[model samples]
Target: MKYSYEFYRDHLEMLRIKLPGEIELFADFIEDISIEQKADEYITKVENVLNGLYQDFEIQLNATSVLIKKDMTVLEHFYTYEEPYENEMETEEFKELMLIWKSKIPERFKKKEN
Candidate 1:
């Protein structure tokens, strides 16, 4: 099962904490499923960004590559990345609508599409 930061973030409770039981269930599932072999760069990028370890503000990930830009790259290359996600169109205008399944974007980033 692929997991995205936004997915986890969306499901996180009001206090940014996940319920132990919910997590336990996921752990059980993850432990049993054999994930496809992941590349080293993907794992490395997760470690850097998860800690806010970069001088650069942006970090991203696709299933295959870790995108990083500028001096943030360790004496290597620059170009960058974030979590696995899909684009969807819906507005918080209907926050109470219920039954929405994807993660919610912060209101501040919501904008008029060009």
Candidate 2:
């Protein structure tokens, strides 16, 4: 697989506070809908969903840390965010804000319980 399950799981864990109680169901939703059997495809779908959250809600996600640049292979894009911070987000406070924003998922956006 291009990406291991741990990679995807780690990102999910980082976003755990944002996710609702229906996390297992959400996982199933992403995995079952993936076109590829590999776990990477499911991860891609989950990333897209998270990106959608960022865009739709103007959520301040540190997408540079979690996003996979389309058309680039995993190896090519893996460490791009590991570079020294020098832009608008260079401060530790900004990084902390990103984490807070990541966890600030709107309640309505979470998976609804039946």
Candidate 3:
């Protein structure tokens, strides 16, 4: 399940960091579940922006991938992503949100349109 651009923006806000360019529009690949297979193609383009802002950011990750079952059960699959630090990241609100997001995994993040 892909999030709306606003959702992405909300998360990006928590990073308190600037990206040099536009992220690929969510509309561009909203239907591309197969994107997981070709994610390597986007690494360099995305990494160029992220790496400049964050040393621990996982540019190699296509962290958007989700596993959805017939029962509507969902699981987020991510790797090598760094946890946001309270001191270095955003506010207490952001930290609380992140912790909730991590604890709940796909449950907390399941797209409303799903």
Give the TM-score of each candidate. 0.20, 0.19, 0.20
lDDT of 2 by residue, 9-102 (tens): 2333322322222121222222222123333433434355445533311111222222223322111112235443212211222223223333
How displaced is residue 45 in candidate 3, in Å? 2.1
* Candidate 3 lDDT over residue span 1-114, tens digit each: 121122342342221212212222221222232333244433332343334442322212244432212222122334324432111112222223223333333332344442
Alpha-carbon RMSD of each model? 17.7, 15.5, 16.4
Model 1 per-residue lDDT at 56: 34
- Candidate with top TM-score is 3
Of the two candidates 1 and 2, the one with more favorable TM-score, higher being better, is: 1
Flag regions of model 1 displaced more than 4 Å.
Answer: 1-38, 55-114
Compute the lDDT for candidate 3.
0.28
Q: Taking the tens digit of each residue's C-alpha lDDT, what string does model 1 give over 8-36?
A: 32222221212232222222112222222
Superior candidate under TM-score, 1 versus 3: 3
Better of 1 and 2 by lDDT: 2
